[model samples]
Target: MTPPLEITPLPYHEDPLGYFAVLRDRPGAVLLDSGRPTAPGGRYDILSCDPLALLEVDGAGRVHGDPALAGLSPFAAQQALLDRLSREVPESDLPFLGGLIGYWSYDLGQRLEPVAGQARPAVTLPASRVGLYDWALIQDHDRRESWLVGSAARRDEVLAWLSAAARPAEAFRLTAPFAAELSREEYLARFHAVQAYIRAGDCYQINLAQRFSAPYAGDLWAAYRRLRKATPTPYAGYQAWTGPEGERAILSLSPERFLECRDGRVETRPIKGTRPRGATPTEDRRLAAELEASLKDRAENVMITDLLRNDLGRVCRPGSVRVPTLCGLESYANVHHLVSVITGELAADKRPMDLLAAAFPGGSITGAPKVRAMQIIDELEPSRRSAYCGSLGYVDVRGRMDTSIAIRSVVAEAGRLHLWGGGGLVADSKGDEEYAETLDKIRHLMNALATPTNDDKWNKKDLHLVDRDIDIQ
Candidate 1:
């Protein structure tokens, strides 16, 4: 009998900024999903509530948070970084995701000059064909093909910092505004292009999106109350937190899952398909049941699940793979979705980097086969997806980690903002209704982005999925 996969067991030491500082020095990748040095001593802890850490990675499509190697933002630096991160998606073919500023801006159309002396890469040059399996980067500690810091020195330093980091604040302050949006015309044009591009590429599926607004500026607590009362989602919650510099928000809601790594195991739950909740309980159940029974939807769920399972397989012990469930219907405040759970035990030898390497650019966000799907997304979407598909989570000094898929999330640039929302398109998807579904995803964000709506001009942008309708005139 074959011996079960014996992961030689990896020996790891911790540091708050240990190996990360080294990663910062490497070329061409945006650091998404930054791990924070928690309070009480700057201990390594997850800061999923940090608005800044929520920013995503666009590195080679392995979307991790670009750790905040710098300071805070006063404006819409969100989408700007995402666009920068989006550049990484294309380079996976070149097998590189680097050269980033990871900065956000407030004035629309602001541009960042490349750092002096940085190599200006030629676009669309030298293409090589590495064997399918050959192109994947193998991430072993010695292969330390990337940054690999050594010793337990970094771990000890973090505990010391955490011990020193305590102070109480009266209340939080906003360095800048969070709610923002884009114009209707620009959104429509972009959506139209996405529709055309996806079809031209013969993409079996693509998720297209747009932005909306009518910012409801109230206190974070008040906003939380309204959002929860006005709209409820399974993934939505109110989290209150203060960072090193001090800022906080209600964080109204989030409907995606990133990554969850515990004792000796790791798992990623990808959410693929979605439907709106109903007024009546009977209607709600039917919606969930229909999603479960949906052939097109279930197929979409399976494709991502298979892709995730494959990713987990790379970092897990042999025979440790299992899909405990599939196409399970999960309902949320604004939407109902089909979720699949895939789990595995990590090879004692595997590192956090190994887990991420096996599953960069989550399967749920990108379609399958993942590579081709990403290529299609590049061609379909209007701009680079800086953080939309990346992840946000916390990693401790001990290497325990948890991350969420960046979905139902917004990225800002200047006061002009960019956010995306879309559903899986299958053979049965309608041309126009799919467009409406994207709008549904944008509904809450729109309300949050623009000025409060006592004015008569504000109209609820209702989309009719059945008739393939959009109510944006």
Candidate 2:
């Protein structure tokens, strides 16, 4: 049987990411940061590592575990993990104190194909994955409160580890020079192709994207710090792990929340329309106003919102799905977007993963009439999305969950960083304009890469500690 977990309060008030940096090198470490400051002068940051078990779906659409789980379809495999974990840990009053924390890749959708005849691009990364961590550091920035949560047997050890990690650490260096996988001309051509599909009535809208990569030879933590500073969003995260394939890191500065389920109520915030931030305050207000007034943009946002509502309806109580907010404008660091919120109450028998399966590859990123749009995406895009457009967050033992749309994210593996940027295309979309919008979306990430790092920022001289093993109680 799984041991009972415990939570112990701490008095530290330093930057959560800085504390996370000390543990980032540990396998299965995950940092979920609400980048912007939260109410009462605090933000929420969760740092966890050393998963008790890991649930992963491989590139070939195979689940890694018991025969029963592996034999089930990929989406079913994910749901099984959630079900088993909840049964093992039971519900907790603390939201994320002890639960599964990880990500779901975009390619996991392949398992849900209604028919077997469709072709799909190959994915280079694990298709769908989640990790069940035994220990975590939960920080509430507003209240200046922090807690080390773990099994009761290991409380003393966990507290000691946290106190040690509170000390400063050495800084690492990183230099990345990025190159776009698709040239401007090539991206424009693809945009036109998506428009052709829309014109053909294959779909009214589709989200098209391009990939960019840079060779890196240094510290990923340092780079992530710079990224968070450059583009602070409500949903920012960093994940590090070492598997059979080697070490991998994912850094995300996403502004969109794909799903949030609490107390059996599910909510999705889909972002469909985007406009670049203006050079001046007046220009910014004008751009936001223009976006609010654009019929085309509003229509696009509504379409995705409706799509999400339908998705929620599948696992939610019948007639419970509703659109509470429609086409609201939300401005971020680099862009202003048209967003809509959809809410529903999960059916009595449904699990969190049921809601995830019904809405995989979020509607905002896929376009209207999701399945058809996805097929077209496979045909038009040269490669698989992998982690892009996927969801990353935590599913608590209580079954409460929250995940962000993995846009404006970077995947780091084998000393290379991969990034993607894209936009939704409607029948009236212009190829050049859409391509430019893609550039605007990735501007902050690119800037973070270009900005040089300073060694002095780490203040490593003060850290006189060595790494110690964290013993779970």
Tens-place lDDT per residue, model 1, 66-131, is: 444223221123323323322112211111111111221111101111112121111111110000
Q: Pick the candidate with the highest TM-score.
A: 2
Worst 10 residues of 2 by lDDT: 464-473
List the RMSD of every prediction in angstroms.
Answer: 14.5, 7.5
For candidate 1, what is the lDDT? 0.43
lDDT for model 2, on a 0 to 1 scale? 0.75
Which 10 successive residues of model 1 have the least lDDT summed? 125-134
Residue 417 in model 1: lDDT: 31
